[model samples]
Target: MNTPGTLYLIPTVLADDTAAQVLPPQVAERVAALSYFLVENARTARRFIKSVAPQQVIEELSLTVIDKDSTEAQIQAALHPVAAGQDAGVLSEAGCPGIADPGAELARRAHQLGLRVVPLVGPSSLLLALMASGMNGQSFAFHGYLPIERPRRVAALKQLEKQAISQHQTQLFIETPYRNQQLLDDLLATLQPGTRLCVAASLTAPTEYVRTDTIAGWRKQGAPQLHKQPAVFLIGA
Candidate 1:
C-alpha cells in the first residue's frame, strides 16, 4: 500500500462569468479525500471544511494545520507525514494556496525531502485581472505587495508604468486590503492621466466588482471604498 506522504494545494473558482473554474461540491469532495491538511489560516480552513460537510460528522480530522507564520521546522515536521504517504492538503484563507501566496516555501521544502506535492483548483485574482486588463498576458510579472514607503513606492510605480506602456509586457501586482486606497493614491500621483488602471475588487464574492479605465476616470471615482474586502490593483502604461 502506498503511504500518504503526498500533499495537494487546490485553487478556488474565479468569480468571472467566463472563468474556467468551479467550486462547492467539487471542493468539498477534494477536502474530504485529504487525510490531513496544512492551512494558511486554521480558522478559515476549518470554516471552509465545515461549510463543505456541514451534515457529515468527522471523528478526528487532525489536518495538521499551518499558516504563513508557521516556522520552517514546523513546516518540515508537517510535511514528514506527507512525504511518508500521509497526505496533507494545503489551503489559503481564500482562493488557491501557494502561487504568489504562502505554501510555496513549504512546498519547496517538501520537494527537497522527496515528497510529492499536489495543487488543487481555485480562484486567483491575479490571472482574473490579467484576463480582463485587455493587456498582453503573453508575458507578465506579479510584484506581490509593493513598498509602503511613499518615495520608494512612487518611484517603483513610475518605473513599472513606463515599462508596461513602452514594452507592452503587462505588469501585475497587489497590495494589502487596507493599504489599497493609499497605494492607488500614490499610483495616481506618480502616473499620468492617460495611463490605464484596472481594479478588481471582492473577486468571487457577493459584492465583486471590476473596472478598467484611465487614471483620470479613476480619480473622478474618488478612491474605491474597499473598506476591508480583498482586491487586486493592476496598471499599465
Candidate 2:
C-alpha cells in the first residue's frame, strides 16, 4: 500500500500587496514545492502563488476549488492526488486556512483519511487584532459574522456583551466589509457604556488601524469610516 502524502495548510496574506512583509520565507519555499493545491478561489490562489514564487509556472500547477458549496464527494476527489502519495496544499482566500474558512472541512477529511496535515506560519488577521486589542487573549471566542438584520444583530451583540462580562472572556466577531460602519454604529448603541470595544481594520496593510475604547468613548470620538475595508471587532469588559 502507498503511503498518503502530507496535506499542507498554507496561509495567504490578510491584506492586498503585503505578502512580502507578512508571509515568512519558508511559506514560499513550501508553496513552491507543491504542484497540487486546494483553494477557495483558483484565480486569487494562482495570483498569490505567482506573487510569492514568481519563478513557479502557474500553468503547470493544479488548483482545485473547495468552497462553501463543495460537497463531501468533491472534497474527497480534491484530495485524491494527496491520498495517492502526491503532496498537496490548501490555501485560503485570506488569513490562515481552516480558521473561519472552508478549508476546515478539507483538513477534517484529510485527518480521517490518515493523511499527514501540516500548517505553515503566516499572518492571521484575527490573531493580530486580538494581540493588539488588549482584551482577554487567554480565553476568547471568534464569531465569524453577525446577523445582517438590525434587530437580530443588536440582540446578538447584547448576548455577546453579557458573555464577555460574565465569563471574563473576549468576544470577537467580524462583519461584511461594506457593513462595517453599520456594525460599529450598532455596537456603540447596543453595548453598555463601559464595555470595551476594539476595531481593527485593514490589518497588515499600509492603512491598518487598531483602537480599543469604551463604547461611550467611541461614541464621543465618532466612528471611523470603515466602509469596504476588511475589519475585526471585539468586545470585552
Candidate 3:
C-alpha cells in the first residue's frame, strides 16, 4: 500500500508587504518545495511565489484553481496528486486556507483519502481582529458575510448582537470591500447603541485601522471611509 503524500494548507499574505513584515521565511520555503498547488488565483499565487523565491521556475509549477464555490469532484481532482504520493499545497487568495476558504474542501477530501494535512502558521485577519478587539476572545464566532438583502441583513445583525449580549461571545463577520461603509452604516443603525463594534480595516497594510467603540460612539465620530478597503468587523460583549 502506498502511503499518501501530505497536503499543506498554506496561508498567503494579507497585504503586499506582509511577506517581509509578517510572514516567516519558512512559509516561502515550504511553498517553494511543493510542485503541486491548488490556489484561489493562479496569477496571485504565482506572483506571491515569485516574490519570495525569485530563483524559482514559476512556469514549471502545477497550479490548480479552487475557490469557495468549487465542487466535490473538483476538490477530489485537486487532491489526486497527494493520494499518488506527491506533496500538494492549497493556497487561498489571502490569509490561511480551510478556515473560511473554499480550499477547505481540498483539505477535507485529503483527510478522507488518508493523506496527511499540514497547516502552516501565517496571518489571519479574523484572529488578529479578535486579539485586538478587547472583546470576548475566548468565545467567539466568525459569520463570514451577513445577508445582502436589507431586511435579512438587519435580522442577521440583530441575531448576532443577541448572541453577543446574551452569551458574551464575540460575533465576527465581513462585508464586500465596496460595501464596507454601507455595512458599517447598517451595523450602527441596527445594533443596540451600547453594543461594541470593532472595525479592523486594511489589516497588515500601510493604512491599517483598528478601533473598538460603542455603536453610539461610532455615530458621533461620523462614518469612516472603509469603501474598497479590505476589512474585518466584530460585534460582541
TM-score of each: 0.87, 0.99, 0.97
Candidates arranged by TM-score, highest first: 2, 3, 1
The superposed Cα distance between candidate 3 and the true structure at residue 95, in angstroms, equals 0.4
Which pairs of residues clash in candidate 3, taking residues 3 or more apart in a chain or in different chains? none
Superposed model 1: Cα runs more than 4 Å off: 1-4, 12-21, 55-59
Cα deviation at 232, candidate 1, in Å, is 0.7
Candidate 3 structure, TM-score to reference? 0.97
Q: Across residues 82-196, which tens digit of lDDT does each residue of candidate 3 receive?
A: 8988998888889999878887788788889888999998999999999989999889999998899989999999999999999999999998899998899899999888999
* Candidate 1 structure, TM-score to reference: 0.87
State each candidate's clash count.
Answer: 15, 0, 0
lDDT (tens digit, per residue) of candidate 1 on 1-237? 665577778654434332233464566677777657777776666766666656534446776667767789898888877766776778776677777767787778887887777776566788877887786788777888788888889988988898888887778888878888788778777788998888888876668778888898888886677766577778776
lDDT of 2 by residue, 218-237 (tens): 98999999999999999999
Model 2 alpha-carbon drift over 4 Å, by segment: none
C-alpha lDDT of residue 165 in model 3: 95
